[model samples]
Target: MHHTIEVEDLYFTYPDGREALRGVNLTVPPGVKMTLVGPNGAGKSTLMLHLNGILRGEGRVRVAGMEMNEENLPRIRAAVGMVFQNPDDQLFSLTVFDDVAFGPLHMGLPEADVLLRVETALRAVGMSEYRNRVSHHLSMGEKKRIAIATVLSMHPEILVLDEPSAGLDPRARRMLINLLKGLDMTMLISSHDMPLVAELAEQTAIMDNGQVVACGPTAQLLADHALLERHGLAP
Candidate 1:
């Protein structure tokens, strides 16, 4: 079985002495969409950081069969795309075109190819019309979409996202959902929105206290009212 992402007995601790992850074991198969549901301090973000070598942790971590180490970090980052919780954190360029094209441009691709990638990614996220608009002038929802496009332009195999629908209005939310539906790649999403999770993920993992308590089919996990209540996923 080939896994796009793999981890074995992973452990991570913050400099402030907070143990963010405790022996996390996870595997994301190629082309699978898995949502991670957990409380604020459950270490979901920490785990995601480990995927592309943003934060090196103890034990084994692998992406697309390559171990997560200094030597493999660059290739791992190219294979994995991460969209942060805040669009502002990810989008710093003056224009949408620049932000979306940043990754490909930095990779030494020809200018024509970089432009093509930027256009394709913008179209994929339904942001092609705003390609020349200033990033700071866009609405929250628009910024989010562009942030996604910026990463998508890299043509990564694994897409990791955190709170993708944080500030989207109803219409924008629907658009984002539809956009996600059209994507045919392995996705690791972390969000508090249960409805979105139901629509996007085929599988789900429940994490708490720095560990994954359970993982299985999305419907089965979400249907467990008692389990959800215990973990604060339900009220």
Candidate 2:
């Protein structure tokens, strides 16, 4: 079977000698949606970094059948689109349109194609009207949408998101959920939002101290309060 992402015996550590991941082995099939639910220090963000070769770790890590290395960095990055926790960090251009068009331009696409991709990506996230607006002037929700569009312009096959729902009100959260649901890419979302996981993911993995403690169907994991509590996902 073809897998979109593969992680085997992966290990990562910070510069300060803090171990982040310990022997993590994970495989994500093409087009599958998975959620990673873990505590603040469980290394969810660290693991996401490895998906696109941002932070290399020990052992094998692959995306879209390509191994993570300097040889495959460009291809791997084009295949894995990561939406960071903060939109401000992702969208840095002066105008929203420029921010969304940056990725395609960096990939060396033609002017016409780059503009077309920018327009399509913004429309996909329902933010086409704000294309000319300044990135710094947009609200949190709008910024988040533009961030997604920025990556979407690259036409990534795997979409990795970290805390996509953080700091959003109920309405904006729902809107973001709807936007995600409409996409057709393989999604790997790391969030603490139980309801969002239950609504979107078929599989869920709970991690602690950089290790996966439990992984199974989303419904099964959510149904077990004991397991949830063990992972600090429950009150």
Candidate 3:
């Protein structure tokens, strides 16, 4: 079976000689919603950066059947939609419509097609009513949804998120969780929120010291208290 995302023997290091990923390997099958959980400095974010060619590292990273390379970056980025932990990082346009339309516009799509994509994406995130509103004025929950809408307009095959539940309150977190549950694309989310992981992921991979230490069904992994405790996921 073909994988939607594949990382094999990945290795990455910062300029200061700090290793962020070491021989990491992971795979996400098509249409799978998987979560990567681990303590701080586990290289989850580092690994995510490689998904869209934001941070080139030593290893074979493939997404939607395309290998990571300078020549393939444009196509690869179009295939993988990355949602950062901070919604602010993703939304910059004055209006929610423009923010969501940026990707399709850049793709040189027709005006009608761009409008359609923007509308479809906003509807998908349940933010269609806020299309004309200022992106920066919305609440955190609203912003998160809009951020996702911006990515959805690109029509990516894979959705990669980093710490999606990071600063959200309970209500916003719940909303975010529901929003994620409704997305049908392949997803690889890096989050510390175990409950969110349990709710959204069918599969889970535990990362530590820059490597994937374990991978299995969410229920099986979450049931392992000793493993969770050892990895600082549970007390």
Candidate 4:
């Protein structure tokens, strides 16, 4: 009965006077797979940042029952894995193994445990063979998988991904989808891919202009063409 992710009256404004989130209130119970659909500049990415306290705002944000603040930022980040929109941002190590081991090592795990986590995570994403590959030389799909392995190594209770399927070829996208379906943690995905949403999310939330406009069962919302159109999610 516990909520894995919670935001109450959350508001975020950039230093340059750009408001991204407006009183966003939502909760995802443990182990639920949810999709966030929104057009450009809808604050979906901003909201994801709030989950791990990357971009703090005005209101209560909690992950796995821990309040997100400076004192608990480290633990909160360890518990909530975020796969950013751009794989380049996540993979920066000279080799894929270093990138995947970065989080666990930073958390100060034993060297043996860190290596184990890196191997297990890479294997989970089916990228174990690329352990020694340089990230800068990897293809887009390989980088994406390596990015995911970096977070998976942390063993986060909740997984937040932004545009996970973006810029991938059909085969790569399908492989990513299959990898997601096999995961067993709470997932919050922000994507405009309706087909992926329909296949992966049990619940869907529609966002626009920094607020959640409508949320409910995925099938019901997908069936409502008018609602999708109203939110600029459909043609």
Best by lDDT: 3
Query: Candidate 1 residues 100-198, lDDT tens each?
Result: 999999999999999999999999998889988999999988998999999999999989999888888998889888988899999999999899999
What candidate 4 gets wrong by more than 4 Å, as runs, is: none
Q: Each model's C-alpha lDDT?
A: 0.91, 0.91, 0.93, 0.92
Off by over 4 Å in 1: none
**Separate clash counts for every candidate:** 0, 0, 0, 0
| Residue lDDT tens for model 3, 100-141 | 999899999999999999999998988889999999999988
lDDT of 4 by residue, 72-173 (tens): 988898898999989999888899999999999998999999999999999999999999989999988889989999999999999999999999999999
TM-score quality measure for candidate 1: 0.98
After superposing candidate 2 on the true structure, give the runs of residues whose Cα lies further than 4 Å from its correct spot. none
How high is each candidate's TM-score?
0.98, 0.98, 0.98, 0.97
What would the per-residue lDDT of candidate 2 be over residues 105-197, giving only the tens digit for each residue?
988999999999999999999998998999999888888889999999999999999999998889889999999989988999999998999
All candidates: CA RMSD (Å) = 1.0, 1.0, 0.9, 1.1
TM-score-best of 3 and 4: 3
